[model samples]
Target: MIGRFKAELFLILATVVWGGTFPVISELLSFVDAAYIVGFRFLISAVILFPFLFKGGLFLRIRQGLVDGFILGSLTFSGFYLQTVGLNYTTPARSAFITQLLLIYVLIFQVFAKRKRPTIWNVISTVILFIGAVILVDPFALEGKLNKGDIITGLSAAAFAAYIIRIDHVKSEGRMVSILFSQFVLCSVLGFTLSFVQDAPVPIFNFTSVGFILYLAIPATLFATYTMLKYQPKTTPMRASILYSLEPIFATLITILFLGIWPLKHEVIGGSIVFFAVILSEVSPLLRHTTKPEPKN
Candidate 1:
């Protein structure tokens, strides 16, 4: 019981870090191109993780390195690419709601890949969550015609879902360290390469952009990735999936408190629906554990 709580705590912290990305990236928009922002993020993250890569002769575990590398890397990088670029066109609420479709995608992928059906509670919760998301996004409030950014952000959610699914495919007691390193390497190489290909402008050396990049590189990339890789397998994917919903909530709060940004009434109502849905889904499992019969002495 204590262990589970600790794990949840770590997951929450990871979610908070992820949530922080919204504002940090929003700030960086003034001085850095999205692609270059991603590129530098991975570049610095890879450098920070360099010591760990060689600590255990990481390359020696190379049976599926390349395959896992590209698959996870592309999924992770493409998601960021889509979300960051998409933000340029869409409101933050819309982008966050759309990106969060990955939660549903994760559940669906788990069902097919693992041959496991969702419990009744899972289905109910998912529906509730969707309602909340609709409220939060306020689809009617969209700025422009459904454009390339919206499509790309939606596609990015799917890609990120694929990445999470692949994490399940690579079976090991916990090869998380190696797997993460491979992912970082691939992301760094791909992002940097694409930066050049896209003719992304060079990032200026402003204190704000540099600080934002560092925050993203260290806490968001290194810490959150490490936590997810370490603790995700301990809990059901459903639980992990639901916990991630907290990201948008935290982001919303941060935006409100610091930036004085507030959601519309409908958006708030919708978000509550999504929040209730996730809680509804988890209540059954939580109750079952609490109410189960005691073991015989």
Candidate 2:
């Protein structure tokens, strides 16, 4: 089993990589339809994981892998689909802010679905995270009316929260490889189908676009997801969500470094607060410091 601190670190690194992906995808979207890139990304990852089918006792438990992969793939696809669809109706910033609601949805699921109560630190971290997300996204810049896009994106957040909860339950030794392979295959098929159905424009094939796809396939999806599956189950769902919330903050720093785009004042302030929230969650156990009872009293 993975140690808790190591798992948390791996997941945080996964989120950091995930955060840095925005610019790559944003650049690709200029010349490629969303569906095409999504399809290719999963297809490449699926191909890379194909060799794992013959290893890791995968064949012994192939059935379990299939079922769990379908469950996970479907949830992941739904989350992505909802957010993609919602983006058509809402601004990206607004949608991003709404997606952070996953932190709350995970808490609710933990309490209602798993019969686990949130620690006080979880509640505090969540509140701080939400405030930071709102400030970072600056939803006030958008229209005052509640949009359909926000509602759809909110559902996406719930789907992702559910995915997080289910993954911890289903992850097992020797099966993650097969499960990941199956998920990639399923997602590739769905992405291709969605592209066809939407009649998305043909993707431009160039060194830059191909490089972007390879980066996403190899690093963002394959490596990052591998770490997530291998490590996230060792930590609390609340902790995982809180760490993922650091994505926007990482994105801010990445932008400054690579794109030379400086953040707005709100973005900087909000990002700082969000980073602090993750720090608070991480050190919460240390803060409790409960005294031990007298021996043999």
Candidate 3:
């Protein structure tokens, strides 16, 4: 029980760290292109983890890690690339909220790919989540036109969902670090190549930019990924998803701090609804199990 609690707490902290990146990345984007930012961040991370690749027995797992890492890295790079590009076209708050659609995408993937049916509570939570997203985005305010960023952000959510599903399926034991290291290398290579091809502006290495990049590469990328990979398998998927939903809340808070503007009334309401829906999804299962009568021995 204590171990489980610690794992959950670490996962939430990792999510919070991820949430903090939205504002930092948004700020960095002003000075550097998205690909450059992604490239450097992953490059730094891969460098930090490079020594692990040479550990005595680690070579044995390289082949497996390469295959799994390629798949995971592709999904991760796609998600981050889309999210960063989408940031150019939308507010951080909206982008974060839209990305939460990943939870719904996971459900859809399970239904179709795994041939599984969602529980009634799962359906209920999904509906609530949808309504909350609609309120948060408020498409009507845009004259029925979706922002390009929102559409791209939605696609990013799907990619992230696929990533999550793949993680659940792969369950690569004892080689997670190797897998993650390979993923960093792949992302770094992809990011740098894309940056050069797109002719992204070279990032200025001022104190401010360097500080943000260090923060992102160290805490947000390395620490967060390590904790998530280490701890997530210990918890239920629904619980992890619910915890991840908190990222938008943290993102909204950071956004408010950086922008100095309070969220509009609808945003507050919609974000609250989405948060509660996530909580309900996790809670309902516990409620059902507890309410069931014990069978006579």
What's the candidate order when arranged by decreasing TM-score? 3, 1, 2
- Report the number of the highest-TM-score candidate: 3
Q: lDDT values of the candidates?
A: 0.75, 0.75, 0.85
Worst 10 residues of 1 by lDDT: 55-64
Cα-based lDDT at residue 259, candidate 1:
61
- Residue 40, candidate 1: C-alpha displacement in angstroms: 1.0
TM-score per candidate: 0.82, 0.78, 0.90
Rank list by lDDT: 3, 2, 1
Supply every candidate's count of residue pairs whose N, Cα or C atoms clash at under 3 angstroms.
Answer: 3, 0, 0
Summing lDDT over every window of 10 consecutive residues in candidate 3, give the lowest-scoring window.
55-64
Report the lDDT tens digits of candidate 2 across residue range 114-147.
Answer: 9998888789978997787667656676685446
lDDT score at residue 40, model 3, on the 0-100 scale: 83
* All candidates: CA RMSD (Å): 4.1, 4.4, 2.6
* lDDT, model 3, position 232: 91
lDDT of 2 at 161: 91
Q: Which ten residues in a row have the lowest lDDT in candidate 2?
A: 285-294
**What is the lDDT for 137 in model 1?**
56
